[model samples]
Target: MNELYKVDTQDPVGEVWLLSDFQNMRTELCEGERCIYPNDLTKTLFHKDLPRFPLLVKYICANDWLSVQVHPDDELAKSLEGDPWGKNECWYFLQKGRIAAGITRQEKPLEDLRNGDLRILTPERGDLACLQAGTVHSLGPGSKVIEIQQASDMTYRIYDWGRGRELHLDKARVATKAAASAIVIEEMRKFDWKYFSIELTKKVEGSGIVITLSEVPELHVLIDDREEFSEEALLVRPGSFWSELL
Candidate 1:
């Protein structure tokens, strides 16, 4: 995707944050002919007490297996990491491939199942995999996806496939659940998720990604002709969003 999009980077580009509003990393939001950073639009776009944007969008391109990880829910997030939000993400596959999601057998120890002891699911292009918080998952090699999730990035890495990275087994053990739910594959269209809702469409031409807020008068659109991803998302307001595919 980096080569296809002509993005120049010194290191391998694993993830591209399309829309974000964290304190350290922020994406510009365009309203009409004006463009402003999301952090600066809090007065008009967010409530006075809200900390950050409600949703996050990213383009993930993996050539190898990603870390097997899990995320905490709202209660766990606040108690463990002092974060206001937890990550409950969905992946919209751009390329047909496989993914390691959920444990294959319920009785096996999670530590013993760290090395690829998970169910392998094959999802074709345009299929969406909804992964709620605490669901253990890993993206397979040669898979590209558009990820939509809560604004937080609280990931607890259970395994790194012998990368020697620090493991969070203790926290992961507490956050892990035997059978929260299985990943569901469905066609991408409109999704009314717990944290946020998304509506997808295809565009022949015009802007790169346009986000229209349903309740607010303001419209935030991301315009970048250089971006050539198969699909990209636009975050409207909290609990509402719009996505487009080129």
Candidate 2:
């Protein structure tokens, strides 16, 4: 059975963490915190049954901007880096504002990222974006939402907006290459179903992809099929399940 786990908040950014123990999501709250996977149950289940958990869900908050980052795929992570986990994530904006996301340069060669001339894109509220494994991306100031994908925490930071702090340049460069190697941005298409599905609109600027979807309670269930059941939803408030629904 699927279960909802509350996310613990962490520092640097404010966010609530929700994870299933089966997924072993460590960072309960706060943004930029790493979610650990291969939870005890997933580990045991994999050993016993071989195939069990398929995906991981995360709640992210970005009061301030996050480090520019990317993630590796499973094969690259395992064979090249020897890391067991790699990231593949998609974002659904729950609450939005003047937020930033996606890579800055569209036509520039990946090598330019090394020269550090890449630009950044700032998206408005109600935007949706997909970050396939290894896509260089970051969350801008004042953004919060849910991220769903494979369970992994391997990230590569490419840039930090001259905040004047010590940065992980070495790892960021390595991760940038990994992300650049597997970059893929398909135009966002709208859902055709009229009775239930929400419409999606997308555009591409520079090298980044931007998307906008309708913001309404009716659209919530369209993001995830499991959201329909009150028991399966993540209650952000003490009685949010009953109150929000009512």
Candidate 3:
């Protein structure tokens, strides 16, 4: 799927980290030489105590099937794993097909291990799904997506389609619960929360003027949906950035 993400994987494309302080293999552009963490801008944008970027931005392409997995919340992660953060994410569908997220109701022990009343959906382009921490979910085939989540890699893979990966059933059973949410098929006003927030703008006129008021970093994406959806992203620091359309 070179069109969306520049990858050539036949299997489910696990992750493509665009910008990260702690997880990227690609080095940052430093002193006219390409080195790790090219941007010292993380500290300038976010909390001084945070070692790296608090958010992990990625694009995932699931050509085939993905494993049913759950991520722990912050408290559990800190207590059990001693990790700093947990993953809470939102997905934007590029080329959508099927997806299984959460369940009809939270079942004790999650019987038969992955075949409980799972909510299946077929969402088209421009659809959004907000998956909070502890949500059990899976990305089905033919789905190309952009995901924004907390910068943590502790995914408890619960069920793996008999692919023979290790399963964390005990943790999954405890992490997951019956959660209700609707697929947002229309234009979003904004997704505001304690962790992160997002706003999708359509036909964004000529340019964008972003004014940053607080310490938190702001991610601005200008998507041109005229012919094909071509996007340019700018990480707005603690000040203002006036973008010019080329």
Candidate 4:
């Protein structure tokens, strides 16, 4: 792990929050003698009515299969959880691995998927998988990935591989969408989604304006692309930012 996120662990660490504003577990930033958390920083960088930071970025190291889970969309999130954002996430793989994404067919029952039958996708290093809300998915073993998503942490787990962890099958059934699935992208340098944009590059040639809901936006950059990726992040006012080689 990078010293920025280093931790003492007896068991394998599943995930690291690189930039998150989730309560209690939020990441912090320091400027000279001042230190602030992302949630508090949002109040100054965004509208006063803004509930929280709009993005969550993480580094996940999956030693075992993750829960077969689904997330609610913005509409469902508002009605079900009374939250402002829904999770629409993407994974940039740093290690070759497999993942289960959506149902194999429209007729495949969600119950059958709970028993471990799923459509598997093998993604190579440098591949990106964009997963919109309601996509039933699971990360397979040995996947080292960078995940960027909407700020919400609402996950409805469908299955847990007999780990005996609580399964949110009822909520997951409501959240699962037959049409939702992972869109695996390869050789793509840039991604512009509804909430944010991401670029994977060794070089950035020019200046760019980051268009987002917030007038001022924060950019999370993953530096030194290796096993344990490092981070270089900055907050830009009026949503403008510069680009250069990492």
Candidate 5:
């Protein structure tokens, strides 16, 4: 997702996979362009043949505004795209400002409701937004977001603010919710769906401990290039991920 449209140089890392849907993901193991696919883990977790990762996690840092868009709900997604799962995502704001969420209903055309019907919510650092399926949303400049969403990338554009992308008014009319579905997360931890969960780690011993509350059976820690954990130099960035140190 290294699009030329991305604005911030510090946030050039648009997307990466912690684990991925196997068809599109490859891992490097050797100097001779060795590639390994992550099909085994994803298959064992879901117990089915999947095209790609079931959950997609990424960081979205926008130096400028993004296109106003909406994702299809489960039923519509299945009927139209033949995909049983629709996208329901939540955003954890690292740097926050104005982000458009939800919609205001008017009896007019879909194009008219694009800008006028949206509401802006100001979320500071550590705030979360759980966006249900079919909620229309957009991100503005100076916003750094950590997004976790269902694997489907089916987006129906209402309007792009003149970005000139093709607008999907027909599908958007069926997909968007009439009442606003965007939620400003009121709780520190929310279990929205079975696909994933979001929780804030408490400050332990005056140190922030960020942990994932997953039902997965084991915590396989990798250290010193091995599949194990040991006391070593551990690094954490508040809003970003860096695998190496300079």
Candidate 6:
């Protein structure tokens, strides 16, 4: 059986004061921490239903900026952190205005961060980035995205602007140490369809990106080969709702 999970919305920096409103607009499935799926699907599937597909999809609407964060790699997470799996994510920009992504002060050395001179990279609309675990990144304000990733909720926040709250700097620093060794600060190459059965295309608009997904029915079981279906096309608009296939 197929199940859908909604993500739990959180405000780490308190910048997203209206998270409740934005949470209603977008949908997400953050496993272990804030999963909306009411079943033990995350645990049962990979074990009992080996042949069944276990993919989690989400529509993220960032009303306010998120903290600068990074996820741990599988080996490092498993060996050092004792996590069974790690995170690998891809982002499709739906609406983009004053957006920033990627690592900016990668080669700047730890001294830059100590001296408070670390620079961060921001992304624009029509940009697609594949986040390999351990990549330090964050999204700027006025951005919406369709995020597809491994079903794990192991995010390590590095920095959050001081907004009348204190962050867990000790834990965050530990996570940063594990991830700092692998941070890459370059333009991420677009996802290639040759690697996966699906293809995504994007067109630039005023402050948004019109995204299109192309797939061959033979390659995807959920997508029908007979006729064109609107449900098959997942469309995400900024400050709006997210659509998914059941």
Question: How should the candidates be ordered by lDDT, best one leading?
Answer: 1, 4, 3, 5, 2, 6
Expressed as tens digits, the lDDT of each residue in 1-246 for candidate 4 is 433246666665677776777778777766578667766645344434367766677777788889899999877888889886578888877769778887866676675674245678889977889999999999999887777777788998877888888878788888888777899988546666655566654333333212121112234321122221133222212121111101
Model 1 lDDT tens row, 1-246: 567556788877788777788776888766579777755644344334456755677778898899988889877988999887677888877778678888767677666665357778888876888887888888898787777777787888988889898888888888887676446567666666645655554342332234321211122343332332244433323342212100
In the range 129-198, model 2's lDDT, one tens digit per residue, is 5555656666666665655555555666565667665555565455554324222223323321111112
Question: Ten-residue segment with the worst summed lDDT in candidate 2?
Answer: 237-246
Q: What is the lDDT, from 0 to 100, of the residue 117 in candidate 3?
A: 54
- In candidate 3, stretches whose alpha carbon ends up further than 4 angstroms from where it belongs are 2-14, 23-39, 105-108, 180-185, 201-246
Cα distance off (Å), candidate 3, residue 102: 1.6
Misplaced by over 4 Å in model 5 are: 1-36, 47-51, 202-246
Q: TM-score for every candidate vs. truth?
A: 0.77, 0.50, 0.71, 0.77, 0.69, 0.51
Q: Candidate 5, residues 1-246: lDDT per residue as tens digits? A: 344344456545544444335354543223257444444334444445565536555556676667778888767888989885787787777655568887765566677765556787778766778888878788767776667777677888887778688989888888888675667764334443455655453222221112232211111211123221232211111111111101
Candidate 3 vs candidate 6: which has greater TM-score?
3
What digit string (tens of lDDT, one per residue) describes model 3 on residues 142-162?
Answer: 886677677787888877888
Candidate with better lDDT, 1 vs 6: 1
The positional error of residue 37 in candidate 2, measured at the CA in angstroms, is 12
RMSD in order of candidates = 7.4, 12.8, 8.5, 8.0, 9.6, 11.6
Candidate 4 residue pairs that clash: none
Off by over 4 Å in 4: 1-6, 43-48, 114-116, 202-246
lDDT, candidate 2, at 183: 22
lDDT assessment of candidate 4: 0.67
